[model samples]
Target chain A: MFDIAAVAVTIAIMITMYRAIKGPTIYDRVLAGNAIGTKTVILLVLIGFVHDRPHFLDLAVVYPLINFIATIAFLKYREMGRLD
Target chain B: MIDVMLLLIIVVCAIFALFMKDLLSATIILGIYSFIMATIFTRLNAVDVAFTEASVGAGITSVLMIAALSRTKRYEYHYTKLQRRKPSALFLKVISLLLVIITGAVLVYGTIDMPEFGDPEAPANKHVSPRYIAESEHETSEKNIVTAVLAGYRGYDTLGETTVIFTAGICVILLLRRRINT
Candidate 1:
């Protein structure tokens, strides 16, 4: 069951990778990158299920926590050109 | 089957990243590659490695690359005729291509003798990992084997990783902080 979800997400990741690579604008790439990050968080959890290793769920917990910070930092830097 | 599919996609992403003219798009594609690779690592039961790859490869590296791109040219442009005529540059490119091909061939050849995936009798699985798995709960009182190994038996390595992250945080502060009076 979870394997199906993982395969679906994997398909989504491939589609987003296409956009990330072939997108015409910088914003399109950024959006694709953000989408990939979110899907990665879900994929991480689904993978834990597929492997029957729930102990690794803590790792998935960290993905959403850090991925947003990365996406926001990228957008922030793009807008202001500085970290501060 | 899924692992093979993921591996193929990862290779495609890496090739596209190499061929991209826009540095920003390349960085983004590389992030996707990292994410998928982390997924593969998770599938292989290397949860600690996957965790580190997710945090460092997909998150920190993507952030660092974007920060770097903001300070540099967005596009990777071809050199002007004068710059392109430099013999040293052309020589370096030829040397790099040869080196890369040689190294890749060696690595591929090395994989031919590798044990099948998750082979229970593999030397890597035969060694200390089983002991760690058996003793970790009793020794560290931790339910997670990875956490137990990292934070208990290999505490020094985890300490070093923490120190590195701390140093990076400090460097970011030093570089990005603005003085009130200045």
Candidate 2:
């Protein structure tokens, strides 16, 4: 069931949170944040199915589209020290 | 049950964000917090609010925060003086802690009279939501009551939000504009 899947994802989020918090480098933190974002996208879809409201799937679509840009920007900034 | 899990994660993220020595990592943690918060909003059935939180929190704010971080030192040092607990700093910390505790206590006390969650007879439930849900389709011809309420009935509020964003854009351009020759 979706509830079991959601619980699995929630546990994964907690594990990823540990990585994000205990980061030994900014890159590690960024990767952890990106992983969390990806999980969030999946969780959003799972939540939609669980709630029987597919409209929230639209959010699942939009979240990844933007979060990737953020991770890329983070990497680009770290690499170049400038956004442009 | 899941809300409890998410809320606990949010608390951990906040504490880590506060104590993080690296500013960039703190910003990323904050992004995670915001992203999870959006998930919670979606679970609570506020799709539009969740959309805003995801885009603004995980995307724009993270990018902007990193950009801002470029001009600052990454680490906040707890130097010898701080480690030794300077009297003024100790006093300030105590004051802030007391203020936070008092504020939280006041808020909790204030909620004592609030109706239980999901109570149909709650004041918020007894309010205009009934009318909005029942009449929005007929009044605005919008099938989604949220859209109708935002775009039709509360048009001015949305306009104000637009105006605020526009002003922020203009301010950024004005502050950052530069001449090529210069």
Highest TM-score: which candidate?
A: 2
Off by over 4 Å in 2: B81-83, B163-182
Candidate 1 has an fnat equal to 0.73
Q: Show the lowest summed lDDT stretch of 10 residues, model 2 chain A.
A: A75-84
DockQ of each: 0.61, 0.56
Q: lDDT by residue for model 1 over A1-84, one digit each (tens)?
A: 998898898888888878888788878888888888788878888887777877667787777765665667667777777666
**What value does the lDDT take at residue B114 in candidate 1?**
95
lDDT of 1 by residue, B49-108 (tens): 886787777767777777777777888988898887799989999999999999999999
Per-residue C-alpha lDDT of model 2 across residues B60-123, encoded as one tens digit per residue:
7777776677777667776696565888878888999999999999999999999997899998
Residue B117: error of model 2 in Å?
2.2
lDDT of 2 by residue, A1-84 (tens): 999999999999999988888878788888899999999999999999998988767668878877776787677776776654
Question: Among all windows of ten consecutive residues in candidate 1 chain B, which has the lowest summed lDDT?
Answer: B172-181
Lowest summed lDDT across 10 adjacent residues in model 1 chain A is found at: A65-74
